[model samples]
Target chain A: MLSIPIEYYLILSAFMFIVGVTGVLIRRNAIVVFMCIELMLNAANLSLVAFSSYHGNPVGQIFVFFVMTVAAAEATVGLAIIIAIFRNKLTVNVDEINIFKW
Target chain B: MNIELILFIILATIAAVTSILVITRSNAVISAVFLVLNFFALAGLYLLLNAQFISVVQIIVYAGAIMVLFLFVIMLLRTDGEPRIFSDKRYIKYFALLISIFVFIQVSYLLLIGSPSKSVTGNQSASINSGTIETIGKELYTNYIIPFEVAGFLLLAATIGAIILAKKKFE
Candidate 1:
């Protein structure tokens, strides 16, 4: 039963985090940006679980549980905000929705 | 080659590819579908890490509930054929690509050069068992009870706020 080294998990997490960052940087759709944010959150969750397993501590997993909770709340509130904005602006494009721009 | 390692490689590939598709797809619905696939793959990875409870929760919460919410919003908004902004900004895309490549190289270099210190706790079997639902339940109910209650309150507030934000105005 040879287990994977923790470094592999950490590296994978890093890869996912970068992908999420790229998505956030390039995608102009608000929903897509939100999804990328979710991806980043999931990346962090993976690292926490990996370290939890490595350290033989249940604490990290508990933290992951909290992260998931926060993610769910975020999605709910975020989508609602998007809907509200779309109602007033009739668009979800980040560039076009800039009413605050001078 | 061990079966666990093989499973990990296959699952990791699936996760990576689907996540790439998630961000690259022009169609929002298609991206959402790919995101669901990515979540499933990640759940598989969680299983590999011996976090059975978290894996199940990942499927239920992410792939199940959250995705359903996303699809509902997509359909409600009817954003199909919405003009994508990716083509309008070539410089941003190139810059993002360059940054991600730099990050990947930096992380790979560090991971390859630095050896992880061996675990000093030494009870790997016991630690592995801590990821089970039973063990997680005990910890959640005991030491982490206050945080759990706070999370519950957070959800309650979010639910109320969402309703307020999205509710129809009858005036």
Candidate 2:
């Protein structure tokens, strides 16, 4: 079986992160952007897990667990805020919900 | 190409295609499902790297729980079908693509230029050979206990916050 090197995982992470950056930049919907942010986080998590496995220590994997937990929390709080904003503004575009500019 | 490289390419293609579908499709439901495909592809890649625990977690947490939440929100908010044209930042779109290409080039350069380094101690794929779940459990409880507990607390706070945020205002 062909096994990919650790570097390949890093490269994949880089690609996914870039895709996520573009998703955030191009998309108008705040929800899609938020999901893209999650994608970026997951890309980094993939790299961390790969590194930990390559090094045979559980530290990177442990850190990834922490990252996942944080991501979940972020998703919850973020979605809640989005919902609140949507209820108020009647739209979820990043360009429109600028009430906190003061 | 060799089997490993071939498999990597296949998986990479799948992930890339699904991710593009996720981002480009106007329908929120289709996009969410494509994101699930992307996650599953990533989990497969993780398995290739021998991070079995991480792979399973990726499938369970991301593909299972998180996406379910996204679907729930999308349906609850009635945000299906084509997304509306909210922004006209055409210049920023081009800029983002250019930057992504630059980053991809830089990473490819590094990968091509980098030398193969040997593994560190206790990680030579020989020193400690065990299943991913067992090894991760031993390490998480023994060495990384504090962070684990902190993460748990963080999740609890987030759960409460989400409930507070999403609850209907039925006065």
- Best candidate according to TM-score: 1
Best by lDDT: 1
DockQ of each: 0.64, 0.54
Compared with the true structure, what per-residue lDDT tens digits does model 1 show for residues B1-171? 789889988988888888788888888889899999999999998888778899999999999999899989988895745445456667878888999989988987887778463542224686678789999999999999999999999999999999999987523
lDDT by residue (B44-100, candidate 2, tens digit) is 887776677878998999899888888777776755344443344567777888988
TM-score of predicted chain A against the true chain A, for each candidate:
0.96, 0.93
Tens-digit lDDT track of model 2 for A1-102: 214466777777878887888788788777888888988898888778666766666678768877888887887898888887878777777877787797
**TM-scores for the candidates:** 0.94, 0.88
**Which segments of model 2 are wrong by more than 4 Å?**
A1-3, B80-89, B116-131, B169-171
- The lDDT of each candidate is 0.86, 0.76
Each candidate's interface RMSD (Å, one decimal) is: 1.9, 2.9
- Residue pair clashes in candidate 1: none
- Per-residue error (Å), model 2, residue B155: 1.0
